[model samples]
Target: MRILYVTTSFPVYSETFLQREARALIKAGVEIEIISLHAGENSFEGYPVIRFNKGSLLKLLYLLPLAFFRRGGALSAIAREMNVRKPASFLNFAENLLGFGAAIVLEKRIRDYAPDIVHCVWASAPAAFGMMAEALTGVRFSTGAHAYDIFEHGGDWLLQEKLKRAALVHVSTDVAADRIRDLCDSGKVKRIRRGLNALPQAREPRETCPSLRIVCVARLVEKKGFPYQLEIYRRLKEAGIDFEAKIIGDGPMEEEIAAGIKGLGLDDRVALTGRLSEEEVLEELQWADLLFHTGVVAASGDRDGLPNVVPEAMASGAVVIGSPVSGVVEAVEDGVTGFVCAPWEPERWVERCVELQVDAELRRRLSKSAREWVEREFVADRNTGYLLECLEVVSG
Candidate 1:
């Protein structure tokens, strides 16, 4: 079957769920093509990619006037605060007013390709464009809801209409599935957890030292709670705990986080490696004794929908510790696969880290259980198989 996957961006530095899913689909003997806004010149596991030029300059020009005069807040202000809000909202209005002129251009491409199903990754402007293309070409369409799509943009009437018309909808976790059911029909929603590529063989075993090493593989952002993790590290230092920490991702909050690390005198104990390739991440995982992830709901209400890092770390045989937010509880078994801490509690986080560091037997047990859990439930092949099954059923 020919499938057309639509998303906002492609082959970004941070590997997202859609990229992993597309790779898995190709491996599973499915014909897949992806169209997305251009990030850079990179191929996704040899899949065909069509990149659209993002009109950021034009968007900025359009937003400038609205920011100065509009009462409901200008597009510039909204865009500054949220990445998808202004551009998507403004583009949607433009598409509707112009009778889907931009969407018509995409529809021509879709008609030439003649896909059996159009799979959109998020409920944003791209999904709207995909919905229009499907209507024009008579192709079946579906969508996979992520945390930002469901919690941030799902309430838009146009997005809700697309959800109502889709043959099937996929969500990363049961918590997100429940929210989708509230917005649309329960029968149409399916829970398909995100997956990752298989873990590589460890290069070397962790060091046999009293001081344990912990790592957090996430972007430095407000939602990721990197500052809170820093606080936890500071407390660990004060308590004279023997451990090292590494953060392996880059984002907007890098400068602030660097300042924090310097002010707290954790320069020697903590290392901030900007970004690493997938192989590099797995290598670091092999060297680390444990994974410390303190994800929480941001001030803007953006929460976790079961981070892919959790499963990747687990599959790599690292004991996981995460916050008990929306979908994290599903991945972590609380003392079985990993430990769950309360959000924003640095003391609790430090306590868990210290306990796991002190107990070698517990770490071994949790590592074995964690690896088994991911192999059984969260492997990329198994998750994408379920997605393809849903597509077949939906398109029938």
Candidate 2:
């Protein structure tokens, strides 16, 4: 099957899941191409990436004749669909309006590729291309709805419209799938996790340590809840817990997080290591006894759809303490797979830390269960193979 992937950007660090998923699909003999809305690397991992300028009105005008000749039915359908949904702001309105016009150009491009499936990675503006492509070419297309598409500010502007048009929607978690199902009002959503390949072997038990070692492996973003992480560590310190803490990964909130650590007088106990390589991240995960995910629903309603590091930390034998936000609930089973704590309660995390610090047996049991769960659910070959099978069925 030939699958054309349309996305809003290319070569993003946070969206590495897309690269991995495409690689897996290609490895299984499915031909794939990427259409990036924003200019970036021309290709990734040998897949040809076609750049479609999001604001190139001149190109839209140039392709008008070709777009019209392809078909007006898809164009009109998309226009009506986009019209019904309310835009969040003037900026959103302009973006979608431009995307709607650009769809004609996208429709022309997709028709020429002649792929059996056109799938958009992010369901917002990118999905507009898929929606228009399917409408013009009569080739079935689909969209992927992650956390931002489903929960951020009531989802993308064209989400419902594209959901109604696509052949099926793909997601990574059951929780997100449930929400998408209600919006779609159908049984069209498929859940396929973008899992890891060649995970490092689970870490050996602690040999020597500066007391209990706690780690948070996430970008320094609002959704990752860096502020909450600092508070938890502060409470841990107040409880006289002699723990060493590290916050791996970096983002826009670096300065704020550093300030928080200093304000809470946690500089001596906690350290921030900016973005690390994939191997380095796994190294940190393996080195720690605890992984804290104090994820919260940010003001924008953006939250994690099961950050890859959660499963990575679990597989590395670090007992996870995740918040009850978004996909975190699906992975951490309160006390079985990993402990689930609310972002509001810093003391609860401290209590878990104290318990794990004192009870190696309890930590070992949770770690064993976490590893087992990850092995069953988040194995790359297994999940990707399942996704490929689903695509084959759909393309037929």
Candidate 3:
């Protein structure tokens, strides 16, 4: 069966989990194609993409009335949902209208491809687009709701419509699924963990080094708690802990993070390796003794459902110290597999890192357990097999 995957971004440096799952589905005998609202820097090697150019707002305004006439019933349904269920603000209304126009464009693509199923990777604008496409074409659609898309609001009026109409909604964590159950039918929501591409193999012990090699792989965003992590590193250095810290990934907060590092006088010890290739990330992880990922709830209520880097870090046997904010806590296992601390507790975070740095035996024990746990639960072939089964069940 042919499955069309729709998302806001394609070939993103940070969202390789989507590609991994699509590739796994292909291996399971399902033909897959991607349609993205915007294209990114890296290109997927084999999979084909239908990229929608973000045309000017004037052009979009001109097309909005045409889209409304083409899918008037769909627009009316969204309006009813907004009035009765979740009242959308003016901003939400504008965004939804824009998404509707995009969906009309996608409908033409869907009609041409005539896929067996439509799957949206994000439940925000992309899901709204999918909802409109399904309405216009009578083709079944499902959505994979990630962190921000599920939690944050953007024309949330459309979400209930999508939920009621979608054949299935896949969430990466039970925490996310439970929250979604409040908005839609409980039976339709499924928990499907995003799986990793590789499992680490047995290797010789990492040789002892003079300084602790610590790394953090995350976009420099408010929720990532990069500033908090830097403060903890500063205190570690002030306490005379010998270590070198490297942060991977970049975002709008690069200047803020740089300023924070400078303010704390951590420039000598800490470095921001802005946006590296996947190969470069693996190379950095190879020598790193610890992966400190501190995630927090942003002021906007955006938080991680589960960062793919958490499992990848564990698989690499980099003793993880993650934040116990959301679904991240489920993966860390507190003291067993790795350490978990409150996002607000810098002293505690520093204390744990220092303990792990000094005690090689403890690090080795946790790393072994972490890798074993990830290997057992996070295999793409196994997880995507279940995903395909869900697709079949829902389609039936």
State TM-scores per candidate.
0.86, 0.93, 0.91
Native-to-model Cα distance after best TM-score fit, residue 355 in candidate 2, in Å: 0.9
In terms of TM-score, which candidate is strongest? Answer: 2
Candidate 2: deviation at residue 221, Å? 2.1
Q: Itemize residue pairs with steric clashes in candidate 3.
A: none
Ranking by lDDT: 2, 3, 1
- TM-score for candidate 2, please give it: 0.93
C-alpha lDDT values of all predictions = 0.73, 0.79, 0.79
lDDT of 1: 0.73
RMSD value for candidate 3: 2.7
Q: Estimate the lDDT of model 3.
A: 0.79
Regions more than 4 Å wrong, model 1: 38-42, 54-102, 153-157, 202-209
- Tell me how candidate 2 scores on lDDT: 0.79
lDDT of 2 by residue, 1-396 (tens): 888877777756667777777777777887777777765678886667887765566777667666666666656666677678687666556555555556666665666778988878878767766776666678887788888777878878877777877787889988788777877846788988878776669765563444988888888888988777888888889989899989988889999999999999998999998888777888888889999998988898888899988998999989999998888878789889889998788888888888888777788888888888898888887788987777678878
